[model samples]
Target: MTQPVPTTPRPAGTRPPELEILIPAYNEEHRLPTTLRALGAHLSRLPLRTALRVIDNGSSDRTAEAVDRVAAEGVPVTVTGCAQRGKGAAVKRGVTTSPARWTGFCDADLPTPVTAVDHAVRLLLEGWPVVVGSRRCLGAQLPVRQPLHRRLGGAGFRLLTRRLSGRVTDTQCGLKFFRTSVARELFAGVSCTGFAFDVEAIARARTLGVKVVEFPVAWSDQPGSRFRAGRDGLRVAGELWHLHRARHGTQRPTP
Candidate 1:
């Protein structure tokens, strides 16, 4: 599945980056090895200073041990334990704990390759408050193994998001980058702990007048996703409604 080219252009500049890559893992012991290896190789080739954060979300598996083993290999790796489940909770913990100039979180499965990290960092360097992988954007390529029903669900979700949030082309991409200031501001206000957290984050960023750039991503769908599309979709939709009401509830009075 080829991605559509992005109409949104990145702001331009050249700056050496202090980037922290945050990976939120849940029962990803088998997947972590490949993802970490790919990320390590990519970071080794880059000139930017990079640190890796693996937030273990109370996996019954050996995910924490695998991350510890990788950290022992001399990479600037840090692991945080979030006993609470949910990807959003893990990301919140990691972002708040990481001490980098710029912070970003990627799914531990590496559905989007590490090269996308470079792209996201470049967007941050260019002055965007947040940069995100856009699966709906041009140049994004999804793997053939992706289930059609999930794809259809994603399309519907993006479409509904367009109606709710007018400025974004994609809202649910797992790879996201944020400048430290932006991350601090946005994540502090984040209340969602489930799949709809991405939408909430993006909404808050927009509310704060943060500049966001959605870039095309090269993504591959991986098996063993813990997501249950139908069940999770209902939860996501309900959360979106809650967020919508919260935004309205918090609106400032006009002069």
Candidate 2:
């Protein structure tokens, strides 16, 4: 149900990146530079080959230019514009176009430490097709917490979406990784585009019987988050209802 997202062209002879990390951005000109710097630094130390890309989701500001300015020494950063506007839409575009062995999307803000990538790569190479960071997991650490309202709303969201999420503890965590082929198959069926897209994606994974595992991480709540509790929460609630109904029939397009 997602429109096509374009890929950054690679020279025919070059091997694709081994690790492709996607960051979905909207008007992130100010914060993106720092994130790219930090992420690029961490990626440079890893032995695995890495590719960093940003999905500029119709940003009114110069988010793309910001990415251009803070170039990484080891981790080359590529910026691609997503015509689709929602965060999930941007992530879907990036994931579907990934040409790497391992692909996944993270938030523009480094809420989850970039080091989590180490464990993610480990899990994926260990044969887990899907791996996501979990704030609700046993070893999770929350150094900086989300606002009180967000914390409460997140709890309710999890409770309502529990059936769809299954054993996965945190579906909304921005840090998620997947083996390339499995990531594509799951995202190719994504129908919702807003914040609730995570719920829809998880539901699709459940329907397809794809096994998803969560890794605990130290999560810090970053400022300038665009998610409005009252308004966005209602939309997420509505999306959940639609997903529940879809479970009866006609949830996904025929392959």
**Best candidate, lDDT:** 2
Local accuracy of candidate 1 as per-residue lDDT tens digits, 60-138: 9898788778767866566678866788888888777666788888887888867787788777878988888887777
Tens-place lDDT digits, model 2, residues 182-243 = 88898898878889888777777777878788899999999999898778778778888888
Clashes of 2: 0
The whole-model lDDT of each prediction reads 0.77, 0.84
Count of residue pairs whose backbone atoms collide, per candidate: 6, 0
lDDT comparing candidate 2 with the true structure: 0.84
- Regions more than 4 Å wrong, model 2: 1-13, 72-74, 249-255
* Residue clash pairs of candidate 2: none
Segments of candidate 1 deviating more than 4 angstroms: 1-17, 249-255
Supply candidate 2's per-residue lDDT for 8.
Answer: 50
In model 1, the clashing pairs are: 3-138, 3-139, 3-140, 4-137, 4-138, 5-138
Deviation of model 2 at 92, angstroms: 0.5
Give the Cα RMSD of candidate 2. 3.6
